[model samples]
Target: MPCRPSFSSGFDGTSDQDAAMEAADPRGSESDGTWEELRLLKPREVRHLIWEQVPLVDASSSQEYLRHHLPGALHLPHGARLQQLRNVLPDLSQPLILYSNAQNRAAALARRLSNLDYANVYVLGGGIGILLALQDA
Candidate 1:
């Protein structure tokens, strides 16, 4: 039988855990007190954009994030403070791409980032599932 990966809520020295902890913000992307029309990108475009080294922020739950995420993606939990995000992504003008299992979380993060004056914040339309499906195909 093939060996199954063990799951742990605590960090266990794995790359995924490292990535999750590196980008974790317990406060999450809460209401920025403003809303804006989110810029949406198709999965194909996002896939290509990854080659350019644009940071992909996964706004999914930690459990979902541990299960899977895009290569080099950062995990951003809900309710994280804007200041925390600034620490992770210092450049306000840099383009940021966010995704989640459901579009709501990603959209919320995008709005928060945009309200914080992130020059280019976009949400992955249809979420990570679509992107992963495209990858599989």
Candidate 2:
């Protein structure tokens, strides 16, 4: 069998309206009791954006980050550190991209950032694993 790439969207299980609902109130995107957009990006897209954006964030553990991370990726530990991250980051409006080792931590983190009024938060589809798989291939 030929090797094929598989992917999942952060919005796979919900309607756009549902996602919008999630953005309402304190669901996800409502730092100031409002809503924002969560942009989903492919690994390749993130790779390209890294050069100009400098907003790549790795939300994995310190060990995983030390082992591997995209070039110029800043480490934020995880979703809980987002508040402190606000202090560390100079511009909240800067295009922020997030990724994790596996699963959908990137998506979760992206939503959390959206809730915190980040105007440009993006989740890396398939996170770092897809990058590794594509890199190996």
Candidate 3:
């Protein structure tokens, strides 16, 4: 008789493949307010906002930003560059949108911007993924 593989060697309930599947599943998308928490908007919404001249700031690294970014997004990596931002954005009351690949970083940047007395600062809830998705749709 041939020996059978152990259950652990098989699915075991938790595996990289399983994790990927879970992430891809839309079921979890509703539970977390990630889509709404960051006040995510569709590309059309963003475009409308842009036409309104709302300031859009990309918090991703320079290289990541170079690859692709919103039409009028300005790169402003979080931390150590608050002063530089002040120079370009003199009015703190200006509407600002902050985004990164992940919400954690964008949230951190939003907090920093707020602490610096910049009013009307918002973090794009789902970052670039949601924006791209909307555009694709």
Candidate 4:
């Protein structure tokens, strides 16, 4: 969609330091004891993978999701019942991004997903709001 933000990261090669810096940024996620694997992707980075058919989940309730959400995002309720997520997401190794309005619920889901062995779960940093602003820009 035209709303896709331009990816400054550009899916290009990066140095090991770049990786370390990204990992060190505590803004996106907290250490959850399971390898600290949840990544927080900015709108631009998320846009880079938008066209790649990466799976995205809207961790908001169904009602909230129906009001607005990413075009291809799946609706997976958060907390205690994330097995539904496991059933929907078959591979633990594939890249996955989860988002809600401001990422509160999304963060919880990301941590749980990581705990469940999904190694590549990422939270949309500012959620759909940032995506909208980027699209407008």
**What TM-score goes with each of the models?**
0.72, 0.63, 0.65, 0.71
Candidate 2: stretches off by over 4 Å: 1-37
Deviation of model 4 at 88, angstroms: 2.1
What lDDT does each candidate get? 0.70, 0.63, 0.62, 0.70
lDDT of model 2 at position 51: 44
lDDT of 1 by residue, 4-89 (tens): 22222342233432234224322234365333366767655675577667888889998999998776777897986668779989
Whole-model alpha-carbon lDDT for candidate 3? 0.62
In model 3, which range of ten residues has the least summed lDDT? 2-11
Of candidates 4 and 2, the better by TM-score: 4
Q: Give the range where candidate 1 is weakest over 10 consecutive residues by summed lDDT.
A: 2-11
Q: In terms of TM-score, which candidate is strongest?
A: 1
lDDT of 4 by residue, 1-137 (tens): 53433434433434343354355446545455533555778665677677777888889877788887888787887654777767888888999988887677888888887778898888876567666554444
- Full ranking by TM-score: 1, 4, 3, 2
Off by over 4 Å in 1: 1-36
Order the candidates by lDDT, highest first. Answer: 4, 1, 2, 3
RMSD, every candidate, angstroms: 12.7, 9.4, 15.6, 6.0
Whichever of 1 and 3 has more TM-score, that candidate is: 1
